[model samples]
Target: MKNELWQLSACELAEGIREKQFSAEEVIYSVISRIDEHNPRLNAIVADYREEALIAAREADRAISSGEKTGELHGVPVTIKTNVDVEGKPTPNGLPAFEDLIAPADAPVVRNLKKSGAIIIGRTNTPELSMRFTTDNPLHGRTENPWNEEASPGGSSGGASSAAAAGFGPIHHGNDIAGSLRCPSFCCGLATVKPTFGRVPAWLPSATAERGMLAQMISVQGAICREVRDVRLATRIMAHADPRDPFWMPVPFEGWPEMPEPVRIGVTTESYDHPIHPDIVESIERAADYLSDAGYAVERVATPSVNEAAESWLRYVGNEIKTYLMPVAMEHGSETIQQIFEWFFQIGGVSDAEDYREGIKERTSMTREWNLFLEKYPLILSPYLMQPVGAWDSDTKNIEELRKFLNSGIYSLCVS
Candidate 1:
């Protein structure tokens, strides 16, 4: 039982627990110790649940001793983003005003994780209302990037990314709508996938009303992990059936058969007139090369207009945000979040009612073009961030900085 158990992936931990090489309690202790050592400075796991996790771990060990069947993630310690419901825990969503709004039940993904025998060690931080690109809120403070304190950990799932990178646990729960999951993973140098909408069920027991249509379509639950295999494992576990969400499909995790050999991958470095950093371009090229070397027929091919899709996302989803989320930001958000919202409104002008309808019509056409293109190229390698990671507070300093920040992630907001 070494402290290095915290470094094991979810798959390795589960295997070790099943083989009786280590008790589930030992793994939980190791991860909790790691969190205790680093989370004070990182502020990654904002709410500690180590005691409950230990109890769950002991139960998992007993289940093994009894020769009971176990789930795929048995005994693995993980963290949930603060915005998601975890029965009886407060889902403040980085707003102090909602600090007392405890969830009556676990969100769908949380329940699925528990069913997979994953033990929740803590809850991670998020931006105010989970809207910003960095994880800093008046409620829980900021989550620092483990690699560089000054650089962002990426938000609004920065806390999850930070915790994963810090070795607090192997798998962390995160949701993305416009890069919440992807951006944080990119910043913290972790692995994640913004699962296609409907791939995983989602619902918040604490929500007073449903989210906007765009939010419902774009937002998805995902896992942030140190390894890609763990991302797949956690995502598969989280994707288990949950009847609460109508979008939850019964499709198998590996629904599609294996693709033909030499899969054709489309590589695009198009910056849409924005000045992309050389390092970013180099990274994209390097990845493309790796894919090509791995026997994939990689080619630099342009599909539909990403710029147009991004613009539509900015104007349409932006308006949806203004219509649904702006009131909450106005009423409960901090001054910084409020100002950022205003700047977002300025950069992506809110559409009038007629324009909103038009945007939906335009979105359908855009989706069709992408679907048709995907039939030719199943995978596309595109830039996540056009520049290197920015400072933690770059998006909130002023409107210009925020605009620059958004411009750097033009690909992140769209292409869902």
Candidate 2:
């Protein structure tokens, strides 16, 4: 029973602890044993907090014994992505040069998780500067996919996904700027939701400066888990209000009134010049069928232009990266990372200063179009990546391959 504890979902663990079926210490030790067995090979967790975690678990057990009120995630173990703050821990973000940059306080997501009684067992790995889609960095090395070592676990939340799939923990905190959360989940066969923008509060106390405007809008914090229920639970916990992030919304998670009978679901398979993998098309069709069977009004239809939005993302974000982040990358980033940044510029096409302002303005129009479409069809079912998952290093191999990889993610980056 102790050994099997590591295999349970966060939901299961929380219930078990709440019911006194098992002490939090027992569950933590089970997960620690699992990590000891697998982490050396996978390198998913860069910083293990075994001693600290055990202490926390014991405290949680004591609180339960005292019959105190418990939080939603009481005693469930989770891993925080190294990019975010964990108070007193270094948020290296997979960069070696900033190894000493310790955080003074927990980021809002971490605070929420802790407040909900979740214990952090470790900090997960990420690519240098959390820029790449594949997880490898000078700070913590590469995190291997548990299913296929040669395959990518996905980045910049690759470490979180790998750890979650390997049973290091049930909930792994991750943030998505350009599909960082979903891409890793997709690669690792896990479940995650890139919560609507402003749904989850975000802030890094150790950051030297704020991110660019576009990045602030697109990037969001979330969790990856083995079960959709765990994902939903973690997402709700992470959405708790934080005074630090002014963008955080106070909206309820599930209080919306029921839609008219046969809720509309707009389905699209538009690949737009990129080869749409047959498996992806079949997946979409199957999902639409399932929704229809479940009483949804699923319709095959053309929606707004994902390609145009994707292009806008590239141009606007590429220019911001060039202006704001390139200098830092040049100063502290590895050569491989620098080369990848060059390819990003090549594929994304940096906009001039004049065009950059105009593009920012154009974003409003693009968002308006998507919002209007969503008003008619409350839900959209579309292919996230047109092609099947590629090799871990496919994006860094050459310019052409990189472009193909970026093009494949048109739906993902554009939807954000």
Candidate 3:
């Protein structure tokens, strides 16, 4: 029964708890045990309150026994990235300087997760500021991949991905700017989607959102999971209209596609000139081939680049992010963002009228380019990374490369 419990989906686990097939305590303990066995090796969890988790599990059980409608995640253990706020937990966002900075309140995403009946089991590690794709922070050290501890688990979301892949949780909340979520999912062999931008609200008290060229780009907060159904479930749980977020667009919660068991899929191991690992290319093709055999259109082709999406991400996020680095910069800290800031600082943090016009011109061209592509393919299959995961040490090896994005920070943490 214990082994069987490990195989259950998020929904299945909830049902078991609800039906008294097993108590919430049973479920939580099983998960906690898994975390104990695996997380130490993976080093994914930086801070944990297992005793608190058990108490929360009891409350969830009581709520169920009292006949109140239990939340979707009642008794389900979920790991929050250290970057996100969780009451007493300091949302360091991978920064050592802010390790003592506790959030007075839960971030909206956390509030929503709790409202939906999920248990906050632990906090995961992340690269400083979650700036890189590989997860390693000065405060919490690196999170190793489950498949190969020597390799990366991918950054920012790396700890989350590691936990999820190793069965730490059925679903994990994740954020993305430069592929923090998607890259790790690719490497870890899971499914994650970064919805059209602004779909997920972003509000961290200490953190600022990027501005300017990134205004139209999406900086969504969503979930990662082993099953597709869990993805949709967690998304619904978190996608409420937050008027506080100027960018939140209301998407239909009820009539999402209930397509056949197999949906039409467009698969590609290539996108632009960025080469993906041969094994990954083969894996994607094999998955596509299997899907094709399962009756889905598994065609290989070039995917549309969201024009200005990356640039827009930089700009919009930059607008807010530039400020995050300012205090640190003034103190001559953060060797990572310093060089990039150097270029911006030279311009005196002010774009000339001509520069503003040129930035706008580039955005228009990029948006136009993206729309042309998404128009054809509603769902795309593309490579998640260029190479296999390497030691977490690689990220800090050449601190200069962090600025260049040559070594994807926690964003590329994966099984490869």
Candidate 4:
């Protein structure tokens, strides 16, 4: 059981612990040992908490023995991405200058995870300021994909994805402003949901200022997991109320009424001429087929042009990045990251102040179109990445590669 404990999902681990099939200490030991064995080469988890985790596991076991109530994630080990605040730990966000900038307190996501009885096993890596699509930085080096050493694990939350795939733990915390959560999940063949904005409370205790409007509206905290059940469980825990985040919504995690009989699902393989791979198209079709076979009324339908939304995102968010975040990148980020930022600006083409205001006004129309479409078809099955995952450093090679990388994820950016 010790040897195979790391392979279990969060739900399974919690149930086993509750049933006294395995002590929390045994589970922690197994996961920590697995991390110790493989983490050196992967560099997925930069801030290991093995000693502290073992102690917490022992306490969890004691509580269980005493017949105390346990949270849904009790005894399950999880990793926090380095970008989020973890009390007393450095939230470098892969920047060397901020490598020693310790967090004043846990972010809402961390607090909620702790309250849910999840053990913090380690802190995963991210790209500098968590801006890029690939995970590599001077502070944490790089997090390689377990499936292929040369391929990217997926950016921003790449470390979280790598850790999950390599069997470090059952759940890993991550955030998605654009593709941070879904990209890594796609690359690692895991499960995740970039929850609707305001679903999961989020805040950085060490932050000195507020984020841009687009950042505040779009960014969301979430979890990456090997199983969809674990994703569902972890997301509910993370969605717990927090006063620190003003945007956090009061929403129930489950118990929603079922959809009408024969739920209709919108299916689209429209690439907007972005050069989607045939394999990717086939995958979407196969998934639509599966859903249809499962009693869904799947139909090919056109909603809104994702390309237009994506372009708007680039113009609006790109300008915000230049105005608010570019200074930090220019001053402290590495040459590689700086170059990537340039490519982002060049491709997105920053909008002027008036144009930005108009774009914001126009964004609502786009959202309305999607909402109306969704009201008719409850679910939409579409391609995440238009093509397969690329090499780890493909984005940094040159402008052409960077544009292609961003282009591949148009669907993800459009939603964000």
lDDT of 4 by residue, 1-416 (tens): 67889999999999999999999999999998899899999999999899999999999999999999989888889999999999999999999999999999999999999999999999999999998887999988999999999999998999999999999999999999989999999998999999999899999999999999889999999999999999999999999999999999998878955788799999988888889999999999999989989999999998688999998998899988999888998899999988888888999999999999999898999999988887888799999999899999999899999888778888998889
lDDT of each: 0.91, 0.92, 0.68, 0.92
lDDT of 1 by residue, 105-181 (tens): 99999999999899999999999999988999999998999999999999989999999999998999999999999
Order of quality (lDDT): 4, 2, 1, 3
TM-score of each: 0.98, 0.98, 0.83, 0.99
Error of 4 at 239 (Å): 0.3
Give residue 186's lDDT in candidate 3 (0 to 100). Answer: 64
In model 2, the clashing pairs are none
What are the RMSDs of all candidates, in order? 1.1, 1.0, 4.7, 0.9
In the predicted model 4, the residue pairs found to clash are none
Per-residue lDDT, model 4, residue 182, is 96
Worst 10 residues of 2 by lDDT: 254-263
Report model 3's TM-score to 2 decimal places: 0.83
**How well does candidate 2 score on lDDT at residue 265?**
95
